[model samples]
Target: MAWLLVLQGCAGWQSALDPKGPAAGELAWLIWFFTGLCAVVWVLVMVALVAPLMMRSPARSEPLALDAGAEHRKVRLVVTAVGVTALILVGLTLLSFFANRTLAAIGSDAALTIRVTGHQWWWEVRYEAAQPSRILTTANEIHIPAGEPVRLVLTSTDVIHSFWVPSIAGKLDLIPGYVNVLDIKADKPGVYRGQCAEFCGAQHANMGTFIIAEPRPQFDGWLNDQLRAAAAPTSADAKAGADLFLKRACVMCHRIGGTVAGGTVAPDLTHIASRQTLAAGTLTMSRGNLAAWIADPQGIKPGSHMPVVDLDGDELNAIVAYLEGLK
Candidate 1:
């Protein structure tokens, strides 16, 4: 019985009940209100059904003229039920309208705008700024300041993908050639998990992302760090790896700032080592995982858009070492 109690839920970081922001709180309230309303209505319906059966007397063999009082009572009950149902529906419709308005108002004065582009199995996150140099780009992980509403301009380069972070906001679809705006604000500093809610391909289940909310100063510092170019490889193996990376076809799809390997087709590797995860969110960033991903992407994530780059043992190790130094 205790083991089964886990079904009650732990209010995890990904849980809607564990709201960390205004949008999430509103959504959570809506969920609870509907659930409680339905439960109460269901109970009342069950009681009404059971009470009539219990109060019912044995059936008469020969039916007599219906009583006027009983007929009036039945009519009153039906009328009341219909009125209640109508009220409930109207209330729900009004609630939905206001909730949508509230959610829209949250993003009405968005202080910061982030353009999120969905790929086959990864997310391309970009911080939009007035100045071209201040425009920063990263992948999978998104950093936003606490207490400030951030507007996310969402779109998909390929098929449809839904962005859902239960703790922050509701799901919004990213349809190709269509732009959708979602507003989110975190009340406090925390890391919230997100996933691609819509089914796109084989690795759709593994397509995950993270929203790291922090203080203004910390977020600014992070932005500065991410804006810089990839750190130069100092070690012998790393230098060799860097050379091999440029020489190989890996440079065609990926981009590394301050280097000739500039390609817009894949995730920007300017700060790959700084990110928490690899290949969208399939694997955590580590030496082994980096090497494994570089060697065989198809093995780890089947149907991934990234092709398997041919490399030998030493070459693979060198490339991984170089990428690790990118931070």
Candidate 2:
């Protein structure tokens, strides 16, 4: 009971009861209504059980004959109760159907569409644009304008994964070779946390992302910035780091715009430093974290695709410096 009270008080970015969008809000209401109704039914059952126990008496010495009138009354009472129960169940079923329809009605006129591809441990996000040149690609983080509908087309390249942001939308599966569309919106500007609701692999629990809802102008500004190429390194150390990155095994699995590293097997590092977190929310984005990840990725996330780079201290520092300047 105490835990239930604590759960009821949850209003964080990951809580369904603290919904910030139309779909989640409707779902929250439905959940509460169903929960309340179930509680009422449970209480009635408990009372019925306890009432007979509290009124229990010793058995009579002689067997008594059945009263026909009382038996008919009991039969009528049982029939009425069964009918009421059936009516309640049918009403709840219709209510659920209507709620599902309401959820389906949202985002029919979405102005933007994003393609999210699920990997074993990370998310590949692509914001589609009318012009090919205007398309923006990033990973682990999504940005959208508040008060506008956006559709997400989800698919998995390897195994099954589920995209879930409890505060804004419900869980939807991303099956291999199948595209599933989920629409979401935010009523206000805020950051909402999400994770892979399916168990895909060893690092499935670590596969997380964030949705940043901002004003229209701010969202547009962010989109414009993301569409640009990676920033050129200005310092000598950064330039050296960039050289080391290209010379090492990094270029085989990662891509940096305007560079020769054109690997598509990993997350794009074009503007990696601009993101809030790294390694699909495993660590905060920083030079030290980047150096550690490069040096020993298996130590950070076991069974991850990122291999440990056998580089000297100086080489590792230089590489981290270069990647950190990508913003």
Candidate 3:
């Protein structure tokens, strides 16, 4: 509770400037409105609570009494009416704000269609209608062009999932075979943290991702590069690593650009090396972490769909080399 209070204090009223969710702004307004209302009500209630003690007469043992006159009755009735009217006005004001703006914001439409399909512990991301009937598939990491509207079509492969990015948008449920659309926009270029708000399975704790919202030209360049197939390695060692990756079980579950390792079960590794993180946004994209994850995926992310394929020193090195060369 103490920690929670500290966190709440850290996120003071003006902290809404850092909002990432869809309803964040509107909710901030409501928070301030209620805060003011509560303050007024609290002061009024406190005043009422101590009124008798503070207004006690010196001549009487009991509290002070009001004059039993017609004018006094009229004054009391007017105060009561004013209080009730204020309460009613507050209720109506809240109802109006909630009904009109909240639902409309949820249903708003923006450009850029990105389908996010939730799996057991990973996310399958697909860019829809980028071309004529062309869809590009990847995993975990989602990239969007900054300063443009992007509509997310969310779904789940097996169980219920919720998509939440603290710096971009609010939580939306992902149901099977049903696409729940969410609209989001980032004001500037940045990487935002996202998580599976709903618990799905054993690996739910590790089921998180990141949104890389970049400038338009940079995003376009990255998309174009990603749509293309993986290029052959230039060096001899890199070529050997590529051959080893194909020879192993890696090809059965992952896809690389311009290669035969097209499998829909796992993330597209066409440009894995270019990503800033790995293991579905669990670690920073580094060779050391990549090697560790490759050796023991289960240890890093228990209950993941990718099994622990035991690899010796040579094979591990080769696979890491090949994956890193995917850029």
Candidate 4:
């Protein structure tokens, strides 16, 4: 029953055991194979230890002689066991080498490449395109086509971070001034959760993102939509909020498409409302949450790069109204 509970805990959307891609599937097989092999070895050792006790006689009086033949047999047995253990080790090593080769072969002909830059607590996602005009930039959400391999070029702008989506691929480090490429794919259309595996800073636990896999056509449509400029404010309150956003310090750290706010220190706010979460999964996307975050960012996520903005109730509401319409 205890073992059953442990196994059940391993099952989840973000678990490596619940593999959804070729790389993860291969790794899962290796894990099971190694575990089973170790179990068999453990049983054999237990039996060997108990067999001597079971064959002993408690009342024996005579001392057993260590004959030449008995000594030779014991030596042979030890040599054979050592040879078998060595062979098993070599076989497992070869298996791992072949599995790594197979993982490397995937995404060789990838149709998409995304440059993912790691910040202190968020992900800066940029879809590379041959035509500069076709490039798309977003934050915290990665969209890819199901059944097709995609390449991720990873780098860090600040401290080192690890990009890990356990269901799709293994963890890879994003070092400063160095680029590492990770290939991943999704076997089906689903949302897979990911997080920064490395301990970067105070908010490392909250540095989460989502991998959204869809059909090719659907992914293309979404990409096209993201490439367009931010929508214009239509309501009077939203317009006032937009003006306030530009007038205040909000324009110094975030970017809004087709607007003057082009700061690159933080996540882009071009489609902030469209995202499912805010502050790197700190809060769900909503008006109240947005207002709270803008009003007291330190209260929501302490040590975050975003500072608290001073605004009255009317200005705060207008700003929230404007940001909510950005999508």
Candidate 5:
């Protein structure tokens, strides 16, 4: 009995009850309201349980001997009225609360805008309006400043997608031509996991991303760094690798700074070294992982849009060096 009460008190329901990000405190209040409702419901249920045990007359065994029709009708009418009233009150209260809270949250004005465009199985994040025509595109990685309200303007290129970071806020749909805005924030600096909530395609299960909330100064610095275009490799091996990258099959579906290979199908390798992970946030951006992914992309992610590139040992090493020097 005590354990049941404890479980009720500590409801582990995701999103609705247990919140983790900026909206967490606001959602905490909402959970309290629901908890109060549970208390009332529990009390009513107890009364309903006890009433039968206490009021079950001894004459009930011999229904034909007693005047049970009128009493039964009266009891039924009272129970129906009470049940209807209780349900109506609960519904009204919940509706009013939902409207009030949702309106207040949506009406908030001072929020920074982030345009998040969904790709086949990855997210193309950009900081809009900060700079004109200078779009800083990153794949499957969203970095923002902590302690500031940020609104994501979501849209998809192909199928319907959903941007959901359980620890941050609720899921918002990404539809083609229609931009849905989701207001979110973080109080502390950490990396939170996110996933595409809607079923997209074969690689939908692998559609995951990370949200990194940094302090104001750090975030600003990162933003500035991303704004700058990719730089050329300095080392001999890296320079050789850059030439090989341009001459090879990678030029068809990828882009780099000041390069003719301006294909938009794949992620931009402008600053690939600065990124924590690669291949739409699937593999860690290490030398070994990069080598393997470049060798056989289908092996890493079966339905990936990127195809394998056949390069010689020296050429592969040089390409790796050039990519690693992108930071």
Candidate 6:
């Protein structure tokens, strides 16, 4: 029953054992192979331990004498066990080296490169193209083309953080003032949840993101949608809301692509309404949730850099209304 539960835990969307990509599949294979080999070694050791106990004992009259032939056999057994352990260790080391080589090569021919910068608790995902018009930047959520390798250039602006989406690839650390390259690909279209595997700071547990893999055409369409600016307000309420948002303190940290409210300190809100989650995956993206977050960011993510923007009932409603229409 306990083993069954253990296996059940391994079959989730966030489980390393339930691999959905080539990198993760290789890792899972390594894990199971090493575990099985270790189990076999353990069983052999147990048999060796119990073999002496099962052997016939000499009579007390024999005066506890050690047989020369038995002593020779014992020494030979010890030497053989040591030799076997050394061989296993060497084998595992070589296996690790080859596995790492394979993983590194997985992204060597990658056509798409994504620059992922780790903020205090959020992810700034940037897709860069040769042409300036093709570049796109979004926060927290990332959508990639399925069945294609993508190279991720990872870095951190603050403390150390680790990016991990277990079903897709292994965890990689995000060191401050430095960068690391990781290559990942999804075998099929699905949404995979990822979280910071390193202990960053307060609200670390709430720092979540998603990797959505879709068909190439769908992904291209999504990118094109994100590249467009926020649509103009069609209704009176939306226009009033938009007016209040730019006039208030809301423009200090966020940026709206089409508008003049360009602040680079926080997440880009150009197409925030299209995002699936708010506050870095803490809440669902909705009018109520967006209002709650804008009103009190600390309540949703304590220790976050987002400061509280005091807004009256109408002011808050207008701001939330404007943000909700950014899609």
Model 5 TM-score, all chains together? 0.82
Query: lDDT scores for all predictions?
Result: 0.89, 0.87, 0.76, 0.87, 0.76, 0.86
User: TM per model?
Assistant: 0.94, 0.93, 0.80, 0.93, 0.82, 0.94
Query: Positional deviation of 128 in candidate 5, in angstroms?
Result: 0.6
Best by TM-score: 1
Candidates sorted by lDDT, best first: 1, 4, 2, 6, 5, 3
Stretches of model 6 off by over 4 angstroms after superposition: 1-12, 60-64
Off by over 4 Å in 3: 1-17, 20-23, 50-109, 130-134
lDDT of 6 by residue, 121-237 (tens): 899999989999999989998899999999999999988999998999999999989989999999998888788899999978877878889999999999999999888887777
Question: RMSD, model 3, all Cα superposed?
Answer: 5.4
Model 1, range 1-327, lDDT digits (tens) per residue? 321232122225577898999999999999999999999999999998899888956687758957789899999998999999999999988998999999999988887999999998999999999999999989988999999999999999999999998899999999999999999998888778888999999989878888889999999999999999889999999999999989998789999999999988899999999887788777777899899888889989898889988788999999999999998
**Would you list the clashing residue pairs of candidate 1?**
none
Q: Which candidate is the best by lDDT?
A: 1
- Residues 1-327 of candidate 4 have per-residue lDDT tens digits of 222222232225578888988988998899999999989989988987898788854563656744688689879978998998999999999999999998898889999999999998899999999999998889998989999999999999999999998888889999999999999988988877788999999989878877888999999988888888888899999999999999999888898999999988899999898877787767777898899989998887889989988899999999999999987
- Which of candidates 1 and 3 is the stronger one according to TM-score? 1
Model 4 stretches astray by more than 4 angstroms: 1-12, 57-64
| Global Cα lDDT for candidate 4 | 0.87
TM-score of 3: 0.80
After superposing candidate 1 on the true structure, give the runs of residues whose Cα lies further than 4 Å from its correct spot. 1-11, 58-62
Root-mean-square deviation of Cα positions for candidate 5 versus the true structure, in angstroms: 6.7
Which pairs of residues collide in candidate 5?
241-318
Model 6 / residue 14 / CA error / Å:
0.6
